[model samples]
Target chain A: MTETLSIETWRLAASYLFLVLLMIMSQLLKLGHGKEFLMATVRMTLQLVLAGYVLELVFSQQHLLVTLAIMLFMQIFALITIFGRVKGKIGIGLKKVVALALFVGTSIPLAYFMIVVISAEPFYAPRYFIPIAGMTVGNSMTGITLGAERLARVFQTNRARIEEALMLGATPQEAVREFLSDTFSAAIIPTINAMLGMGIIFIPGMMSGQILAGASPLDAIKYQIVIMMGILGSVVFAVYLIIQLGYRTFFNERAQLLGNED
Target chain B: MQNAFSLRNVTYRTILSIPSLDVATGSVFGITGKSGSGKTTLLKLLNNLITSDTGTVNYFGTDVLKIDPVTLRRKVMMVPQAPYIFPGTILENIQLIFNFNRKELPVQVEIESLLELFDMPGMLNKKTANMSGGEKQRLALARVLLLDPETLLLDEPTAALDDENARAVFEYLAWWVGKSGKAVVMISHSEALISEFGGSILALSGGQINSFNEEGSVHD
Candidate 1:
């Protein structure tokens, strides 16, 4: 296969013009986003550059333990992002539950994709492992965060309804079943919408990146299809696990609903 | 008559601190207090909705904390001040009790009878979301009555009703309690209603019982 030509440093730096354009537009419209835009651009560039160097070293080394360690780091970062994004106070136990859900949700599908589907030769090839894991973990993180937030909000706002169900002899599980179903559906909607619009409205980032890196369009499409399926599976699994396990935190062993103190 | 509920030194945070109280079947126990005096909190303790930091609440003879909360709650239902109507028709909301218990739903005639009893015969097919405050309260009552609880912990069940409707609700509750021999512990601000309907009254102040009047008179 022919190697893809790399962009010169000057050409890469030219991308800053887009950020400058955005800042100009923000200034003209008085949108108050000019500073935010500038700061975001700086952060993105610095983070990506550092990440590129780290990836280069990991790829060259091809050490299985190193690859696994990086994967663990990515999972931790994703979990932290989810915890940070949650709006209200969450119990420490619930936070651990969230992390466990993400781990199980992303790791299972990722293992299947790497071992059974792609059948990576060395099994932990960073080139194949990191990107796929990144996509799966990132998407599942968002899904679980949305699911958790929706669950908390629904429980808080509809306390009377939940208690009414409880009063009528419903268990905590039975009482919040509808809300859990709704949260799962709401969490996965963005992924469903993206699937609906893919190829027609816009090319997904992973597929486009693959194509730009000199992979055949057909090969890129195959990878994209499997990765998207893996992501969808992970998100569904993560959200379901979260709603199922996370709900128990809201109630005690006697099935009494825990107040705000928890 | 059996003692329906007995509280001893039940303190729930700073919201409530009842030293001792007993509610018996075949009676209506009125709990009167200013807002934030923990009237609702006391009821929640009886149903095991909230555990007290101190003391025991006994349902029948069993400590409420020792009993299965779901089982205890089924026998001691609570109707909050602002009742929540589940997302469904009035008929569906009434049938929800069976759904929760996993029992066979009552016949259409029984549902219709309940609606009639609640003075909401025309609302059988009406959506709960469209119900007025008074209608929702009656619907909530009808729903709980179908459960046939031994005790009803009502937080101002008729607070949203007009004078006539409120009177009708109390009368129905009185008749129902008399027929079933079930106890009702209700929170109410209306002195006249308390005097007329309350078999015994407990007035709360600053999270403690200020007065206990068996005659149901205004305690000053």
Candidate 2:
């Protein structure tokens, strides 16, 4: 059993040399990404450093209120990010549905994973909760954004086909049925592809992080598998919720298609 | 004779402002107007597709807003101009629309006969993707006809047809409505076509009805 090797502050600074090399090469090639490279390097360093300090405090406290509050913050931040990330303005109705889906969708799987699967001591264990919450919430954010964007695009492009169905006595749900299926598939593909390519395509970040932190490879792989399942569950459920509820936003109370679907 | 739809003070944005109008059942209630004269909007209001900003629209004496929109639309089907021809065979398009409404599939013979009336005999298995503009319009009409709705709203139902084909379609529509005592509210750009077959014509100008044959339905 070998002890995990820790990088001291001075040694960690050496990583920046690789970024500098990339930025210099880009500048030499006139690829026009040198500034972007430099900014990304600085941003990553500052963000990770702040996150590490905050996580240390959160882990030490282990207070239920503190744990829940941080999760809530993560959820809200993810909600705002989805709004910003989606291409179209998600009308207020869909906005509410997205908010509800993110909260409920992420929380259900998270509660089950923490309380039942890991059975973390006292159930609010920050070490177990925060990382898992971050992964599930982050993945769900991506899924919801994709789902929302696809839903909006369909309404725009397929307006005539949808209205025709409506004219043939189709319900709003019936009119958008094919598009919803398309949206759901489009949203979940990235998550599904990652699952297919796991380990073969690349070692996942979580598994690598655990191995570096001195966890056994067997234990790390097990955690990765469960966390991956948790992420898939969150993304699928969140996307499903958004697809089902978000589309109704394009229709009024009488199930008539709204002309202003921006 | 029963009025299929009656309107009073129905205003929808700047597009329509019909003070009063009545469409009697059991005849072709033809509507004529230039494009953007609120002809289509009037049809939409009849089936409760769009709510009027003011005034009540009554469907067979029931205030349209009170009826469930899906139920109302099922009974009063409205086919738009340039109707969508779905990406499959004519049969598939018909089957899909029936599927959407949860209606039972009509017999193969029944479907073939309807297409025959629209001059699309032997088109059941023909791919809709290759249908001409006129054929697609007829296909859309035949699809709705299969539903056998209580009322039909058609926007420019014969706009793409040659006179011969258009005459055949109009003749069938007259027969179809006469046989069942059903009603039709059709918007036609051609005044002559609508005037001849249209039992009680309502002409719209700038979103207002300039003329309506209030007593013509019973005579027709």
Candidate 3:
């Protein structure tokens, strides 16, 4: 195997030239975003370096508890991001569904991938488990956020139509059927488009990273394919769970639509 | 048991309160008050769209809380003040209601006759998207009326109608009630229309019963 060359400190520092160029251009144009750009770059460096140290420690420990803790941490972080990033207010009921979908939707697929697809012996091996779980959870987080937001928006807009159906003796499920289908479609479209554009439109960041890390091109491509499939499965499952369970939150046990959705 | 709806100590969110009210079967029960009188809230309670905060609302002999909401709505349907017109032809709007209840659609001739009753003739294929407010109101009425629910609930069923058309519509409702042996609970702001056709008129003031006229006559 050909070992990839490592960048030295000075060489790594040279990468800041790109940011400096961007800031100079912004200044010349009077864009006023130079501070934001600089702050963002500094924050990214700190976050990635922190993640690197943590991963390095976990890799050395190789304990089941440590790996599981990391997995849980990733999941909670994803859940928080989903809740925070959604555009409008998410009702308490729908918020619970989002958390449930994110946890179960990603975990089940990840377990299956670890057991059957990759067949990791310990299954909680940090090196294999953490990256894969991160990918799965991250992709599903986006899908769930999109699904939750769209579901809330569509329900708010189509409320009168839904109520009219309910008055006509339609079940709550029947009333929101079309809206759920539409929300599911809207949520998953980004993932589908990414899939369509995978090889031709852009080589994925993971595959590029793997190749840069001295893995064979063929090996990198194989990992990319499996990871992409894992992502798609996770996203579809999470979004499906969200739309199905999330809509029920809008209604009561008696099938009466509750007060206004947040 | 002869009453279609029996309400006792019903109150809903400062919108409606009825200490004791009975809507008789086989008659047109008119409810009237100015806006914010909780007229629509009463209809919602009857249809199970909302449960009263405090009080029991019974349908026929059964407490509505014990019944499934979907089944309750099918048996007692409502048409709101500004009815929603689906994005389709008039025939589709009618068919969609039957679809909701999992009942078979009526014959096209039946739908045509209903439209004719509402002063809309030969308009089954016309798109509902372009319909006028009054036409949409009538189309909504035609849709629910075709379903043949045991009790019909209306929220200002003729606010969009002219007096002549409103009177004609009320006459048809009175005739339908007499013919079918079912009941109707309608909310209207116009006292003259209620006085002319309503069998038992109810007037609400600030969500409480201000007057109850059993002879269907409005009190001066």
Candidate 4:
């Protein structure tokens, strides 16, 4: 047989092409809804290609300021994604509160671990800081979005029940007390289940990448454990803050559910 | 025993600009009209679930609009036409509004007392989600009554019950009204219950309370 490219290079190239083909097929088949999928593909390609060029520059310069700026930009972009998904389903004013809560609750602890615990010096080491921040912010964004969307939908659907409770002397929070657990559980379950399936079903991305980068399997596994714990922590903190923020939306001076938008 | 609640020029409209009406205290306050007459909207006004564009709601001769809404809520409660049961034990379902009630009436005591009063003592530990339609109605009644608001605004409390269950539910309510002496404002199409209650009945039509009937042949 004729000699061909090595297996790893061929695998990477084929997979990348297939990913594009899948995006095109999704649009062609009309199986997936919304123009967002096509838009998302375009966004992913453009952003990642731009990110690669920037990272090449970043790696060479390795300036702490550059790393910090990238981390800040990632956090802001994650916040906006969360805001966009949630605001479509709930109050738009809630977006600012959710974004702030997501950043403060998640980023604080994540930055702490990155600097104080991991103790990576120059403090803003792009390789360590950027990926970890991306992972933390990305997962927290999902958790917050799910939490906010579930809460808003529950209130909108069960508003009559809420009003009935108020009529019966329940505070707005107390009225929604039954629903809080439901929302919290809904928000966190996906992460928990993924954690459950992480090892037996499939290796997570970070650990797999670490192994491919020639780290010992055990070292990669330990890193995965630490990252998973960080993710769980970030998800929990973000969801809790959003719930607390979402509850306050229901009341005004008169203790009524602020007028339903639709 | 006393004129329990009052409303003066209590006007409510959707964002779509519907007109408002007023209601007085201690009226049997029959909110009856065609389906889209905003009967529920007007009932929501008394309960303060819906706010009006103009005018004030005065309960106990105090402008309800000015009072703390939480405080006002304790005074004015509603039993929706179709009862909704929270996902909990029957005792918890009944005590839905009492989440902050410090006394926390012993669950057994509250359930036993409410059930015996409403003739449903057997449903104490049952999950509210599984309750039958009649049971849900009784559970809802027990819930609102536990809070003991001065004005009870009921919207079709027995709408879905069988004739026997419906009669039983209304009888329980009528007996409770007599015993509690609170103003019972029920929105029902049941003329038999309306005439039997024998308080002032105001017929609502086209978003206005136009008929005040003292005595009329009552039919279901």
Per-candidate DockQ vs. reference: 0.52, 0.61, 0.62, 0.45
Q: For residues B1-220, could you state the per-residue lDDT of candidate 3 as single tens digits?
A: 2888899999898788788999998778888888888888888888888888898999987999999999999999999887888888988888888999899998889888988989999999999999999999988898898888899999999999988778888998888898888999988776667667757888888888988888545475
lDDT of 4 by residue, B1-220 (tens): 3545555554555322233333434336565667766677766766677677676666666776777777777777777777677888887775555664333655567658778766677777788778788778877887777766677888887787677767776676666666766677777788667677665566666666656564343432
- What docking tier does model 3 reach? medium
RMSD of 3: 2.1
| Residue B150 lDDT, candidate 4, scale 0-100 | 72
TM-score, per-candidate, Cα-based: 0.91, 0.95, 0.95, 0.81
Candidate 1, B38-71: lDDT as tens digits: 7888888889888989999998888988898888
User: Pairs clashing in candidate 2?
Assistant: none
Q: Write the per-residue lDDT of candidate 2 for residues A1-262, one digit (tens) a residue.
A: 3588989988888867898889889988999988888898889989999999999998988799999999999999999888888636567788899999999999999999999988989898999999999999999998898898888889989998888788888999999998999999999999999999999989999999989989998999999999999999999999999999998999989988998311
Candidate 1 displacement at residue A14 in angstroms: 4.6
Better-scoring candidate (lDDT), 3 or 4:
3
- The TM-score ranking, best first, is 2, 3, 1, 4
Off by over 4 Å in 4: A1-49, A60-65, A83-87, A260-262, B1-3, B14-27, B95-97, B106-114, B127-130, B161-181, B213-220
lDDT of 4 by residue, A1-262 (tens): 2233345766756756756777778778976844666677679979988988987878777787788788789888887787666656777656766877687877787877787766787677787777888888888888888988888888779887877677677778888887998999999898899899998999999988777667778888877888888888888988888888777876776777887332
lDDT per residue for candidate 1 within A1-262, as digits (tens), equals 3489899999998978999899889989999989888998899989999999999999998888899899999999998898888835677767877899999999998998899888887878999999999999999998988888887888788877887788778999999988988998999998899899988899999888888889988898899899999899899999889899998988888787877231
CA displacement after TM-score superposition, residue B114 of candidate 4 (Å): 4.6
lDDT of 2: 0.87
lDDT of 3 by residue, A1-262 (tens): 4799899999999999999999999999999999999999999999999999988988887898888788899999999898789746789899999999999999999988987898776888888999999999998998999999998987778788889889998999999887888899988998899999998999999999988889988999899999989999999999999999999999999898888211
> Lowest-scoring 10 consecutive residues by lDDT in candidate 4 chain A?
A1-10
Point out where model 2 deviates above 4 Å: A30-33, A260-262, B214-220
The CA lDDT at A122 in model 1 is: 87
How does each model score on lDDT?
0.85, 0.87, 0.88, 0.73
